[model samples]
Target: NAGVTQTPKFRILKIGQSMTLQCTQDMNHNYMYWYRQDPGMGLKLIYYSVGAGITDKGEVPNGYNVSRSTTEDFPLRLELAAPSQTSVYFCASSYSSGGHEQYFGPGTRLTVT
Candidate 1:
């Protein structure tokens, strides 16, 4: 199975543009997450869902939104993009929330101008 995959490996947006970073895992993991990594900072959780139809904000969900319509898909939406949102975004999943069990996607590099 293809562990985890993300689309549009790279993107550039204007100040107010909007986009959705797509994530899908064929592993059928129940726990999924969206995280952002700045230049030299550790990853910060943006949103997460324990299962389909149950979503919650993470450490940095202010300018982002997420939906889990199925166990394999977790899409992260960036509304009214800002420079502060410029960073590398990652999509991860795990059988449980155990950090060690988590698997990450290739990552999407986004730039806001």
Candidate 2:
């Protein structure tokens, strides 16, 4: 399986710049998630999708958006970056196999200056 992949492994943004974090998987999983981890903090859910054409807000969904139109691509949009958003962003997905494991991507280290 190809699993999940993210682009632009590292990025630094200004106070209000915008960017998109791309995530794609090839494992035919039905659930995908986006999370952010601060300097020394645990993972905070940003957004998640049960399947294509369906999406929902997570714990920390502010300043972010997501879409899942197919079974493979799920991208995260950062409308206005902020210092508070300076953290490591990770994309993860899990199969709907009755509480299966969540596989995480490498990560996107974002810095808001």
Candidate 3:
């Protein structure tokens, strides 16, 4: 199974532009998360969903939004692209949050010019 997948491996956007970063999992995981990794910094959670129709804000959710309408897809939407939002984005999924292993997708590198 394709554990987790992210589309548009790389993207470039101008200020004020908007885009959607797609993420999908074939593992039927119950937990999914979005995270951003800035240069020289650890990954910071942007948003997460425990299951379908249940979503929550993470460490950094400003300028972004997410929805979990199914167990296989969780997409991240950037309302207004900003330079500060330029970073590598990762999508991960886990069957459970209780010490279970999470499968991560190949990161999507975004640059805002």
Per-model TM-score on C-alpha atoms: 0.96, 0.95, 0.98
State each model's CA lDDT, in order.
0.94, 0.92, 0.96
lDDT for each residue of candidate 1 in 1-113, tens digit (9 for 90 to 100): 89999997999999999999999999989999999999779999999999999999999899999999999999999989999999999999999875648999999999999
For candidate 2, write residues 56-100 as lDDT tens digits: 999999999999999898999999988999899999989973679
The segments of candidate 3 whose C-alpha lies over 4 angstroms from its true place after superposition are: none
Higher-TM-score candidate of 1 and 3: 3
Q: Give the winner by lDDT.
A: 3
TM-score winner between candidates 2 and 3: 3
Checking candidate 1 for backbone clashes, the offending pairs are: none
lDDT of 3 by residue, 29-68 (tens): 9999999999789999999999999999999999999999
| Ten contiguous residues minimizing lDDT sum, candidate 3 | 1-10
- For candidate 1, give the lDDT: 0.94
Error (Å) of candidate 1 at residue 85 is 0.4
lDDT-wise, the better of 1 and 3 is 3
- lDDT of model 1 at residue 9? 100
Q: Candidate 3 versus the native: TM-score?
A: 0.98
- Residue 62 error for model 1, in Å? 0.5
